[model samples]
Target: MTSPQPTPAPGRVGSAIGWSYVVTAGRIGSSVIVTFLLAKLLGPSEFGLLAMATVFILFAQTLIQQGLVAAIVQRDKLTAEHLDAAFVVLVLAGLGVGLLTAAVSPLWALINRAPDLTEVCLALSPLVLVQGLSIVPEAILRRELQFRSIAIRTLLASVLSGVVGLALALGGAGIWALVGQQLVNAVAGLVVLWLVCPWRPSRRPKLGAIRELWAFSAHAANAGLGSLISSKADILFTGIFFGPVATGIYRLAARLPDMLVDVTVRSIQQVSLSSLSRLQQDRARFAAHLVQLQHLGAVAGLPVLGVLAATARPLVEFLGPQWAGTEIPLQLLCVFGAVNVFGVLLGPALQAIGQPGKLAAILWSRGLLGVATLAAVGALITSDDPVGQATAVAVAGIAIQLTVNAASIWVTVHRVARASIGRFLAPTGPAVLAALAASLVPFATDRLGVDELGPLARLLVVGAAAGLVAAAVLWSTDRPLRQLVTPRLMRLRRTRAATGTPAGAHSVEASATRSTEK
Candidate 1:
């Protein structure tokens, strides 16, 4: 048995955040390249097939990877037995999930009336096992605050997998390019994780260890399952009703917002969960820290999503004419993404405070609401036009989701944590104002005849205008952010002067490697 480590120091926490952003940036860049290339090469039908198979992969991976790995991170104390037991459980779960997916692939395809998807699903089944193998190790790295290693693994895997996918696409491999990309990413990431992480699981599974972890992990898994259902419901409905082409269009529309959330919101959530969990026992610190993170999320995440929504038309047009129908849905989804920026923290905050059951309840409620609303929208919005149907459904779905997320945030911040609602929401005013002010830039550009420019040129000009406006507004109004940034800049300058050496990626990676080795 080992005693729990203390909370991470500010410097370590800062490094964790930096590396997390590095990983996020790398993934976003690679994803943008690979995704557009494949979309252009294979067209809508192929992507729709990939999306269908991915739905199953996402669900199954959540089952195997979410619960126990989260338990390991949230637990106050951990031992070799716990790690070993979690690893064994994940491995077994992965094997079972992969086999089940393979067996059910045909049935799923049959249900969807897409015979081609059967093979696609089968091809992607092994991802469950490959991805599962890395979960515990990845969790261990997170728990240890070894984000630099994780960053490296992530960047490397993304780049390599993007190359593979691109090469296959260029070779006219169709949807298999997408399929191969996922598998290679999972496998490459797993290999890098094993290489970087020092912990090796022994072949021992203890019932006691599993039970101790299950106390938290069960709820964590349930909450994750619910969240997944909520997130994936729109895709499910679109695919089933509108077929692959419509599904593909809707999927692309959702993709940018989803990627923005992943890059901004989820990355922050990952770092925050670890930090918040460490501060759980200190009430004042915990509450203050939570609110500050909310402020950060609003200031940082909201503006980016707003800009994306504002520039959605030009951005989607740049993708190709095949994506002509994506603009409205993308804009709607960006609004959902904005709501997520504010509400996403509620889950992690609850989880950190040892209220997994509460989080689970909130998420399940959201999931139910999401499903019901999406179903109603799907049924009510009868149209021969797929794009129109998708837009209608998106409007309805995003509206309901916004309400649910707002309520969830209220429960977590106002009711459970007993934080001041005004204080929790203080930053949002400036954030929304800034986001709105920034959004006007793209509209102004359009008014100035920027629409006559090429899609890429319009995107660049509009994106730049929005970004500059957002930055200026935030810099002017977000005092807390300014306060946070000034000190960091000062510290960096002082450190640079003291060392007379640049502190860059190589240095961060090297230091992290040394720390890992030691």
Candidate 2:
């Protein structure tokens, strides 16, 4: 298979951004629908059981995938032999993980005291295999920045999974429905990746061809494992100490923030990973690009997370009374989400700069800190107040984790590119301030009885209003962010009229030209 090229044009980037918006919307919508259906079909107990199983499966998958697909996107040259070797590695790892999951299914079932989980685990095992096969092809597509195709594939997978899951639930399949949905989604995703992506695995494997790749992969795996442990330790503790009902409630509270994080951080990571990889040879240029990305993420991320944190109570109530206890946890988790924007952007930087070992070390440090925090919190809080304990654990862990992550990324950037912390944080400060200011309006509105509005109306009014206000505030306070994001918005009417393209597209064209020339 041939290596995928960079995005064809600035218009292509815009198009990809548009498609990403659509794909994100689709994923969020599907998640809300699925969650609602499952909540109604199965009570908190069963939902929590499924959530526990899923957390394990997802963490395991992340470990096995080893961030190599990300490595491939960051690497400049992708030979046929490299592709072949990566595919071989993925296949082997996938098969091994699948078999291991299958073998452990009975033991997990016994430990959890849920016989039904044995079937769920066994049925979901194929997902690892399917995902392993699809990783390289999906990476190739991402490298090409052909997110429209990816969006289409994702939509199909979501629909198939939703339909299959709902059907199974209607048929009284219990937790099997959730497991079936995930497996089916994996299969669909693999099929779509195969069909849309041009890469095909070769008949022969080239082990030696991927030595450097394996080194990167190993570091990435270690980092990913650390990240996984850090992120999931709270949930694991909840499952162990508080039982499935509490775990399920906590999961529900976390759902919205998690969805937003996935949509924003994950999408940006895809773009940054590919773009930064191309500029890796130039330390100065790469650092500039990294800062630009960090600023963009802040501009986009802070306002959204701020609003969610501010309105968590209303949001929980609107979702359902069953979700009422999730309000505080959601609010607390949003802090992590805000800090995570910085840490997540650094991942691509590390990959691009060929410093996966440093990334691994940072992740391990954060993970160890997170584990210690969780353990300490669990011991301190009584079992009668599991939610409070979980929240405390999450907040404490995230605080330490973010501190370590920020320091590590700062050190790496300064050492590698002679960058300073002030340069990195300056652009984001104004936007963060703007978002904070906008959040006050919503808090006041909630205090003044506007929150009594219907759920849908409240969401629309508060969300839309806060978004507009925050955008305006940022535009006024942060000239660079405004120029970087929507330069056309600041341009004179005459200039906009002179351009045939929308002022926005015109600005994008100009920016792209400048970028290319540089």
Candidate 3:
């Protein structure tokens, strides 16, 4: 028998961030390749069928976690009683959800009017139990900052799932390819978690012990439900308003462009919440650090949006003729995605400050705004046209989310950092210029014969050149970029004297007090 590798002890937050990046990047990269392969092997209609099925699977998976994962991570001290109680509650919830989903599979399909959803739900229901069993253990790993093991296990599952999905699709499995891959991936990951994590829950759950966690868990779960709405509502609206093929196209467009932003934001948020929770007692450090990460997230993420928006044409072609009609939503969502990138830090930052309730409210409000906007826009804008309707859904959903997130961040900063919105956003100003410069290059090059080149070749060359130019522009214009990008030897010339900064503070409760005014 193979000896189980002992999980690494929690390391520095930066190291955890690094490993999380690997895990996230690996998953997304494999996803991209898998998507490409699947798109080639299957038609848009087939993809649409899978998309409909996925709505339930993702919804159930999200419901299973119920954000108790956050409760575990944010709690100051965890005991065996806490673990045992959480495990019991989570497992029971998982089993119940899985069984309920399986029982209702046909009804769900009939309700959605998608006959294929029944088998999809039944196939995917078991994953809920596996996912539920894994959540507490995974949450514990995250709390311990054990991302190395997490990354390894995730990479293993992702790669293996990708291979299986590809082989099955190539073998003409159609939608079953997707269903099988998801189930295999979940089971593989759960098995790995069990092998690596040494913690074993006691036999019984103490209801009283869980009461202390309920306060936080309740808010977390509510926020998660809201997030569930926000994240999946667009798909629901699309499937309802436009049908499966259009939904599939919209899903495709949303996936590739948003992948980078999603990965970067999730990784940064993971690090942000973990680090900020540690610094919660020292308000100044927490404020300053969050400000830094907010800036970092924007600068790192915004350029990709700009690039995607500029290059949508080539990408649409690269996906082949089957994806021809997806360009509009692809383009519109990229723009909204750019707008949304600025507020990535707001939600997690608020949660870090013990305001999950407020965040939950904002998320739900965001969801309502999204659903309302999507439904309203779908009915009103380009109502006669399917693609136009889909584009409107993408735009409305993301725009409401962006608006709500910005307002939430503004409020959080005022309530917690006692700073003006402009001050909090000040570091982000240069990023806009850098992204604009990067974007203009490709657009300009397209006019200068870049478009005549073969599609893939043109994409690579223009993309690489644009990135280099953007780096150069930022390096010349921004001191932070210069310092951050410079080699260790070259960094000697950059002085930290100018970079040294003071801090500010405000409290979440008892009104904003000015103790350490800037």
Cα lDDT tens digits, model 1, 1-518, are 37986888766766776687678878987898788777777787788888888997888889887577678888878999988888888889899998998999999888777889899999899989986788889999888878889999999999999999999999989888888999899889999999999999885567467888888899999999988888888887777777787778778877877787777667767788888899888867787778877776677688888788778888878888877778888887777777777787888899888888888888888788888887887777668776787687678777877788778878888877778888888867778877888777876887899999998899989998898888889888877667656765677778888887675523443332222122
Off by over 4 Å in 2: 1-22, 40-42, 109-116, 167-174, 485-518
**lDDT of all the models against the reference?**
0.81, 0.73, 0.74
Question: Clashing residue pairs in candidate 1, if any?
Answer: none
- Model 3 segments beyond 4 Å from truth? 1-11, 381-385, 487-518
Q: Could you give the candidate ranking by lDDT, starting with the highest?
A: 1, 3, 2
Q: Compared with the true structure, what per-residue lDDT tens digits does model 2 show for residues 29-124?
A: 797788777766765566777777876677658856887886677666678788888888888888998889889888877765667667777777
Q: What C-alpha lDDT, on a 0 to 100 scale, does residue 57 get in candidate 1? A: 81
lDDT tens digits, residues 333-428, model 3? 876677777666777777777889988988898888888887876567655565676677776767686788677876788876565677678877
Q: Per-residue error at 159 for model 2, in Å?
A: 2.9
Return the top candidate by lDDT: 1
The lDDT of model 2 is 0.73
Write down the RMSD of all candidates, one decimal each.
3.7, 3.6, 7.7
How many angstroms is residue 75 displaced in model 1 relative to the true structure, after the best TM-score fit?
A: 0.7
